[model samples]
Target chain A: MMLAQDTREPFFRPEWVSRNADRIVEQLIEHAYLTSIAVGVGSLIAIPVGVYAYRHRRAYVPVTWLAGFLYTIPSLALFAFLTTYTGLTTLTAEIGLVSYTLLILIRNVVAGLEGVPRDTREAARAMGYTPRQLLWRVELPLAFPVIMAGIRVATVTIIGLVTVTSLIGKGGLGKFILQGIQRFFSTPIVVGAVLSVLLAILADVLLLGLQRALTPWARSRPRPEGAR
Target chain B: MSVVSEALAWLSDPVNWSGTAGIPNRVFEHVRISTVTVLAAAMIAVPVGLLIGHTGKGRFVVVTLSNVGRAIPSFAILGLALPVAIKLNLGLGFWPTFIALFALAIPPILTNTYVGVAGVDPDLVEAARGMGMADREILRRLEVRLAAPVIMVGLRTASVEVVATATLAALVAGGGLGRFIIDGFAVRDDARILGGAILVAALAICTELFMGGVEKLARPRTSTA
Candidate 1:
């Protein structure tokens, strides 16, 4: 594939890196910040909602339905719609990004909680532990692996979606992508795409490590080889 | 209040409903592209996923592919594909967007098929074998039937995702309902943007609901004893 006919400017210019180093760092930082904040906020909202849904079987359907509906809204449309009220602010981007995480987190949270063994819960109750105590001590700890899995999925998804926030001028790696597209410059686009993908893989690996560290029991449990 | 009213007015405008760039035409483009992408993805993912599930090998590949798919932004893929497409003389718009959307649709379908098939009860498979069913017969009659709901879930996810992401086609000057949103951005027309968002959201919701219905129907009527 011949990249454009403009052979004067190389597809990847070494000098471009030197000149745009600061801007590249800033965009990477912005991307990380936006993704973390969105994931953080989403977990806060989704966990509680998931807990509520778990406690009340009736609410599970509606809660999941609403989240799923929000998830289905195109990221671009959500950002554009929010721009109407929020006016191209970081808040607008955050709202859209956070909303996408809810469905994944909530469903996972519930599934994790539900997957807790019935015997474990009964034993906890027999030990005279209050419901709240049982939840925090027994249930939540056991649910950590599943919940962490959800968080990993949500975090990775948010990282990808954060690129789209560049559409609203939020100055993430997506900004470089859009700029590169407009100018037909391959350097910035390649740099931005590669960095964003690396960031995603890094975040996923970090989360996996965190999950392993937190859920020691999960690691110790016997399992079929290569079950994952 | 005025925003909503203005968006309604724009949507209701008869002029917006006609012409090659009309709402209907744009929606058609959107649906047509999404349908083609989703079908293409399913055709490839389903068979591969089923094979992996049935044999219980290459499970690692599915997991890795799904992770990579989730990590790469669709926009990045679109951007990356564009220069290559242009370089290959595939032009600017449709093919690049189609390729990106196609990539987006594959992971979910593949993952779901693998999960569905793998999760089928071993006892059921054993019973089928005892009943003189061949491997192919067991897969088609027992595993596939039991795995249908999970497979449908994957299809529904891919469908909604493809439909929603197809909006980015406008970014590459391809046709879709996102034209309204992109054009509005260019001209700073709030009403047009909102109208476009509404249309996109409505389409997504409708697709989700329709697929959900299909899933429910595909579900086994009686417990798999």
Candidate 2:
């Protein structure tokens, strides 16, 4: 009996797995919420800045490069800077996270707006489409795919960065990963890494779908045709 | 009054000279660590990347592995390594930090090298072969030269990354600029905090300027190069 106990033959640990399974779902929910909220909020702000700068047709490079400079700030330092004032709240985290997304999304949106074929913009103007009408009707739909790609990259990056937020007592899968490291526990670390990868893969596939749906025009022609 | 004088005193001390003072030595040491890590990672990763680019197999492996490495983040890798290294009774300070920096520098160099080499024109490669250039000669004459800028771009980014990332070595109890930054923060000293940050910014800018000059010289002098 002592030998059996010491050897620990039962490897499944069904009891432990079942107990934390609810936590896995809860953590996943929290993580998804954190990223979507940041990306969504960031996009709302960036799209307008992008549109404004594109219309001005100047200051685009400098404004966007300035944004890129801010984007390159280390994630830990960024979060720490926010929490210093806001005191470890979700709001600070959101602000810090959302601001980072702006740089990437704004750059993409500007690129997308500029990428709209010159002929199309000229045609819209020739047909007496107002700036507003052209933007709403002609520019936005074509630009959506590239903007969404930026969001995809931003979302994935923020999800990984969310781990640093655990230092602020924000519980999520990051807490699991951090705690696992602190305790030197393999199972929890493995579980967190696997779940995080799964989250990334899931996000990638979802964004792929969204990208295709938004840019149906891209798929409509189906370049290179089938057989390689 | 004495404490205040001492505080300003350290900042103004003209005796603090590069190659002469401990302060400058520390800064150079950090730069040395960063350069060595990037160069080492590049040496291995670039060759592997070129091989992969030329053969065009196992890109899936290269991409997936790099992504996986990136996903873990550098701090976590250091955290994981510290205990294992300690348990093995291995040297902890510089060696451990080097390993972590090496890991962090690999992805960009590998991926960019592969991309730069692969982006070379297949027609040029074929023509060289048709002209009876040996495979080795063709690679030396064409592939490495064509790949230089992309590889340089990768190296540039990687070098900047290591400079930024080397700060985390302080977490492993190895001394670097992060020592000042983290300590300054711990004590709520804005002077030190901002001072350390300023130093890092200065280092990054200087490194970029120097490397830009170096890259200008290193260009292989082809039309495509």
**What does the interface RMSD come to for each candidate?**
2.0, 6.1
Clash totals in order: 0, 0
- Candidate 1 colliding pairs: none
Tens digit per residue, CA lDDT, model 2, B1-225: 342344355445555344422357658777989988998998899989998988898899789867776566454555555445544546556776887788878888999899988999999999999999997887788998888878887887788777866765665556666655566556765444444555565576566667667767667775663
Go through the candidates in order and give the C-alpha RMSD of each one to the true structure: 3.6, 5.8
* Candidate 2 stretches greater than 4 Å from native: A1-27, A168-171, A180-189, A223-228, B1-26, B83-91, B184-194, B201-213
Give lDDT tens digits, candidate 1, residues B70-117.
788888887776666666667666887888888889999999999999
Weakest ten-residue segment in model 1 chain A by summed lDDT = A1-10
Query: Tens digit of lDDT per residue, candidate 2, span A85-134?
Result: 57568887788788878888998899889788888899999999998999
Best by TM-score: 1
TM-score of chain B of 1: 0.95
Pairs of colliding residues, candidate 2 = none
TM-score of chain B of each: 0.95, 0.86
